[model samples]
Target: MLETVRRQRRAAALPYPQMTLAVPVAIEGAALHSGKTVRMTLRPADADHGIVFRRIDLEGGRDVTDIRVRHDRVVETTMSTVVGNAAGARVGTIEHLMAALSGLRVDNVLIEIDGDEVPVLDGSAEVFVDRIEATGLTALDAPRRAIRILKPVVVEDGAKRAALLPGDGFSLAFEIDFDNPVIGRQAIEADLYDPCFADDILRARTFGFLKDQEALRAAGLGQGASLENAIVIDGENILNEDGLRYEDEFVRHKLLDAVGDLSLSGLPLLGRYEGVRSGHAMNNRVLCALMADETAWEVVDFVEASRPAYAAEREMLAISAD
Candidate 1:
């Protein structure tokens, strides 16, 4: 019996195989912060390769630099997520693409770019999700792994906070309160395990306040921000002619950001995440806190899943060395 099982494992017949893109996809647009035109391509990768960003524009593509998408590689969280290597090769605003990959369960991909930031197409993950879906996905010959929260891990900054708690499957709840009357207070909750719900999250666009435009420009940010890419609020009303995508779009966008930020873990997460007015910094901080305490989390394989009382499928989380 042991020999039979060993043979099966060696044959790469795993219960849950990792996934990668079936074909290469490309896109070109203006980066949100830099306001510079850039092009990016997503290519298929081998199993266990993880998601990596390759800077092909560096030194005029003479020597390409690869940066793995992982939490420890995160170097900045100022209005956007930025990952860098020791040599200061950095890529910013990766949260949207990251979220799309996480939702699609794409385990391995090679993202080649000719820019410092991923193009903020409509300030949402919809473009990325659509392109990837059209290209399709293929299963690899390796088992999938996820970080299972064994205990509650929390981080807070004054009134803002984020937490990851033990759960059978992935889910998120977020609440945000803006001073502007147009936004005011809003909250959203979703079972990310559901593909349809995740798709909705991907469509939620990032928002900004028109009042802060000058200040943001002075600080060298939001250089490419415009009504076409983001929902701009002007205190009492939304500046966009088309108006809101969802009634609670403000909060939904926050939840969308959390999905992308938490994906820095470099694997799918099996747990519940709750955030209260949290931003990029707090999201990264919460992840750091979860990883700091060794007893809080464990790597587990997807053996199977069961239909729970909730609408989403509850994964049966476990791992075995054999």
Candidate 2:
């Protein structure tokens, strides 16, 4: 049974046809930093359109922002991923939605938003995933492309670090340590293409220390934050009445953020990503570094299991055949 499942997962992880939503989906919620209610519509796009954001409320939708999902467009990463264009138009707190798109392998989308930031619906990707799934996905005629790591790339800031190495399929390992006893240290590793993503990673709410709430608010951030949208840790206790979604929810959420950050590369990645106490900034830095050295990565249309270009392919095949 285990071997059969591994084979099925490997087959599913193979390069697939480009896909887009079958129909438009709409969502409305409060923006995390601004605390303002906003409406967003996820619309399907043709092949190679990638993911785009249009500020419909500005100039009657003339202000459209193409989300390159790259480091150059990332204007801010202090609290959440913010992408901006040269015209000064920006969309903040996009990671959760991006993660949902990546997890479902939605290749091209046009996100129409009436606000500067995405709504922090439940402070997790769950709501976004639910709506997108409800709309369903349709595969395009074009083949999908993946960014295959040819060599290792690493970035570090103090004790925080993020890296990517050649691998067959997308996988991530993340570790986070917080002084608060409620979190402490936790780590997790999983293949991004696995079914576990929707069940495990998508629902883990973003968390913060109760002590930092006031400071964050003073900094004009987390204005929409409440016990309803996020997990709040006060000392050794959890302030949320329902408690955590997972035993190591903190680290799982970190991995969720990483998935969203890495998806900014515009192409699905075929590599192993490892992060240690890393956040949005570090994740973007590693991606930038990888892209800077063109020799470190290549764009491929398909994964050839026989050639075994990546180390993880051999391991995956071995597990599948066992």
Candidate 3:
């Protein structure tokens, strides 16, 4: 019985599986911030060929710029992290793509876009995950390399802040306080190590304060936004017929964004994150801070994920949860 138990335990540790987006998929939808209609396609990339965005609408009518999920190419950390190239052909509102790829642990992909923003389908990573699943995933012959946070790295903007601290697995604890009654003072602590974005966080749509909707529209934004795609909140009301995906969904959504944004590091970070009213700017700041400091992290040679795991490194985020 003792030997049997030992074998079972070892087998249980066999390793987490590997998956990839099945094939190139074209997606059309609206952007979260700009609310513009976008048409894009997903193409598979070779191993170590991290997530890259190509603006097909550019002058050359090709992928002139490929913004990688690394620290150096980060151009803007505003309403969202905007990564651009020397020619400035950029893809906006990338948090959703980043979230889906990072949350689902997809390492290599090339996202070609015709519009300026990524499609905000369903307002969360669910649609992207679903599309990916529909496209199908297959294992590759490469070992995965994951980033393990060795210590705490914190960044602040006024009272807004975000912090990453060493932990056994990746997690996020967030707190948000809004004056609006519909979503006021919400907090969430999520364990990404267990990796349940498909249920707990993926379906939670993006939200906005009603008072700002018209103002945003007036500014040439939110043109395609509706209750169908986002949470419309008044002082004390939910504009949507449905209430919410979670009781404290706002904070969970924020944490989801953080997970996606931090993934820009081109590595699956193993850490616990805590934030309060921090947005893309602060999030990128924290990542830049970590990159600037050598003590914050070290390059991993290999991730011992599962049974048929590869030996050499180069595959990104292979050991995401395990």
Candidate numbers sorted by lDDT from highest down: 2, 1, 3
lDDT comparing candidate 1 with the true structure = 0.84
Per-residue error for 208 in candidate 2, Å, reads 1.0
TM for candidate 2 is 0.89
List RMSD in Å for every model shown. Answer: 6.2, 4.4, 6.7
Residue pairs clashing, model 3: 15-305, 15-306
* Residue-wise C-alpha lDDT for candidate 3, range 1-322, written one tens digit per residue: 2222223323444433333566887899878767667899988877777788887767663446566666667787655677877777777778877887776667778888887788877777888878876666544456556777788999887789889887655778888887776777988877664435567876677888788888887877777778877888887888889788888878778887888888888877766788999888888888888878889887663333322221222132334325
For model 3, give the RMSD to the true fold. Answer: 6.7
- Residue 180: error of model 2 in Å? 1.3
Lowest-sum lDDT 10-residue window in model 1: 311-320
- Higher TM-score: candidate 2 or 3? 2
Please give the distance, in angstroms, between residue 33's alpha carbon in candidate 2 and its true position after superposition: 0.6
Q: Model 1: clashing residue pairs?
A: none
What lDDT tens digits, residue by residue, belong to model 2 across residues 1-322? 2223335445566545778998999999999999999999999999999998888776633444554556679999999999988777889999999999998888899998989999998888999888877768887888888889999999988999999999867889999988777888899987777656777898889998889999999999999999999999888899999999899988999999999999999999988999999999999999989988999999998453333343466476667766
